[model samples]
Target: MTDYNAPLRDMRFVLHDVFQGPALWARLPALAERVDADTADAILEEAAKITGQLIAPLSRNGDEQGVRFEAGQISTPDGFRESWHTYREGGWVGLGGNPDYDGMGMPKMLGVLFEEMMYAADSSFSLYSALSAGSCLAIDAHASEALKAAYLPKLYSGQWAGTMCLTEPHAGTDLGLIRTRAEPQADGSYQISGSKIFITGGEQDLTENIVHLVLAKLPDAPAGAKGISLFLVPKFLPEADGSLGARNGAHCGSIEHKMGIKASATCVMNFDAATGFLVGEPNKGLAAMFTMMNYERLSIGIQGIGCAEASYQNAARYANERLQSRAASGAQAQQRIADPIIAHGDVRRMLLTMRSLTEGGRAFATYVGQQLDLARYAEDAGEREHAQRLVALLTPVAKAFFTDNGLESCVLGQQVFGGHGYIREWGQEQLVRDVRIAQIYEGTNGIQALDLLGRKVVADGGQGLAAFAAEIRAFAVDAPVHREALLEALVRLENTTRWLLAGVASDANLISATAVEYLHLFGLTAYAYMWARMAAVAQAKLAEDAEFCGAKLACAAFFFERILPRGLALEASVRAGSSSLYGMEAGQF
Candidate 1:
């Protein structure tokens, strides 16, 4: 097993250079008072320590112990409960929540960094925090003032945990098919009846209660996705005095036995005429669920980035320590048996690839996080609207591409270890298995691609793309020499977006069949742009420390020379279209 190390310098580079943290915080009233550079840096350092020191050591043990279910009760792995207590006591779960609700009210950008670090250390442990933050976001957005006042405090305090219950046995992404029903009673509460599957943190012993934000249909509601409504169903029904009362009607039937993330509880939940209160207007549930879903999408992207970073660190460390064949030029001066594996060009290739992707993903996530903050807190309406559209446009890409990179990066990391990577004790194999879910869950990467191409770009008549392109072009115009790669990457993205838009009206299938490849191309181009921007900024800061700047420049060069060409392959695949994919008849086989 490898010890986790927080990439502090890299995080600082991205926070200060890539995103301009101070200026952004100065613009938002909610975060303006406490989010200067020093405070942000301190927060990141503290979060990194907690994740690396407290959470990382428990990862392997958590996996080994898994979550235990006995006699209708659930218990997390050893050390997890202790870590959860530490996390809550440190005010982490509420890092981005409303201040009035016992939250620290940090900006989403900062919270995301903390989140990625946690995921990097132990994703299974991170789930409890991630789900709570997500639930708070949704409730803050859609729930009544009373509900937010009542639930957000406890959730933020980590006295209680939260779960989003949208997936049922018959539906996951297609919520239109969900059969969960909510019937109104005389006292303003509703009776919720249905089963929710794949609910992370649905039922757990880590908290006093589990608050469920469920989606169900009202009897008088319209049909399909339009008819669904959001509800707040807490495990322990609250007293009028705001204290815990009797237990609610919902319970966890069982926890999933999965291929990975065994320590993170995924439950099958049964809401047996559960007492529930509507969070939003009737039949407006899908819109509200999206509040949580979109947040999770970005978090899922971070999951990918985190696991990739973890895998890369392990692989790089192992390569440096393990002696193998001599360098290509043959042993210059014999030290021991041959030389370290890091001496090989191919090994360097894998390490550089991982570094480039992981760093790029982190930068991208921060960029999106900044947009989210601006959308909520910027003074200008136009800026806020633009930020909102950009957030929507980029969320799916971040979620899909980053996770795709995550899976590939982990696989490559495993590949570097050869047979040892596949073995259990080495831990590399576990990462390969665990990171796989980020691609599948939180809306499949395929679904995310379809959303980006179909809804965000084509359906909007290129408005969102135009807004993003205009900003990138503005940045490219002012950027320095090495930023030329960023300019090229943006140009490629613009051309690809234009091509997809042009073909969409004639063939809507352009995105349906080609969306996944388009997503990959888009991700590579965006990441390239991000890497170039980071390198250029780091270079300017080099007088402060040349070694750190040199590393940034090296990673940027590696991305351009080795990784950016992947855009071409993905673009070619996207242009290949559905002719071959859907052409074969059912009888062909």
Candidate 2:
């Protein structure tokens, strides 16, 4: 694998040039005093250094060594524990956390970029801290002030790690089916008893304690999702003085040997009457867990982007250096027997597809981060509501589309490597294995598509989509290039959304059948818009920096010409309805 370099240039281009993140930060009162352009740049630089140096070197070793499970304790791969401490010391875990409790208070717009970098450098190592940040968000949002005071600082400091335990052997997406039981105690704490499977960072030797935000049903609670309750269960119970106390009942029964992210300890956690404190309210656990789940959904999406990026970097490097067949036009390298494979049209096509999709995914994710920042920190109520609506509508799309595209990008990167890509030692195949889970976990891509079409679009009558189209149109007006393409794509997205909304009423199975395609239509259009915005910025700055800006223009053009056309096919499939899907009976197969 080629040494990973954090794409700081592209990231800066997206943040400062395309998104104008610094100006946005200056406007938000919550971020005005906390961050600036120089600060963000410095943070990104520091993050790039650590991720590229400290964390990245461990990725190959982590994958090769994986995790060792002996008896009940789980030990991470070599260098992982020390790297975790180094990461913790850098205050990165709290980059976007609540400042009231010692977090760095960076905006999501910036934090998401850092996340992308970390995942790119080392996905397994990144998982340990990623879950902690998400749990911190959930705890800060729903837990009591006392609980926040107790856990947030330590969580932010990385002195402790956190995990969300929602999935069980019998339940995955269906939270209502979870059989975990939480019985009330005399002093208000409860006894959490059950097993939660596929818990990331569930059992690791990196931290002093592990904080598990668990979901369970109370005895007197209602059935299904309504009956669930959120609880804070720690491996080591904390004393009143903010130090470790007695060991709680939570234990790692065993760790799963996963397809990828092997170094990440995916555990079957057995909470045997563990002492736990209730979070939020009884029968409202699903609502509260979403606080963390949604955060994780987006983070998982970034995992795809990160892996795709790493794959592209290695593939691109290999393409340029690995000499093979001669160029069709002529022998580009006269001194060598054959020119580099990168000279071939098919090779260039593969490389461009990876480049366009990965860069566009970065831009799209940054846009979502901007919306998140606006939702939480915008001054006007109208602005906040608008941003929240867009966030709601796009969160699933971001999760599903980015990941689906991430897998595609990674595959293309691997394809660029031809035979070498299939080899494990090259690291291209590892990226494919690692990124596959992004589509499955944190709510499967199919589930995300259904959520987007049924819940976000149809339930709201496409109000959020309409607002999103309006934003696209507004951008199209100012976009120096690709304006017409952006506008046309916007119309197509709006029309496809309307068609989905209309068909869902008449056909019960229509939404689920076409949800995936509908999401792609939306995602393609979103990327087109992102490309247009990027092209506008790049065009304006062309004279100052011709080479960089010119490349941006070329990428945008490639996206518009080659990539955006996929939306047309997705639209056609959406219009085909559920008839074809229903024709296949279970017994017929």
Identify the leading candidate in terms of TM-score. Answer: 2
| Per-residue accuracy of model 1 over 199-228 as CA lDDT, tens digit each | 999888899988999999999889899999
Clashing residue pairs, candidate 2?
Answer: none
> Clash number for model 1?
0
Candidate 1 residue pairs that clash: none
lDDT of 2: 0.92
Cα lDDT, model 2, residue 494: 87
What is the Å distance of residue 588 in model 1 from its true position?
3.5
lDDT of 2 by residue, 93-212 (tens): 999999999999999999889999998998899999999999999999999988999999999999999999999988998889999999999999999999999999999999999999
Model 2 ranges with Cα > 4 A deviation: none
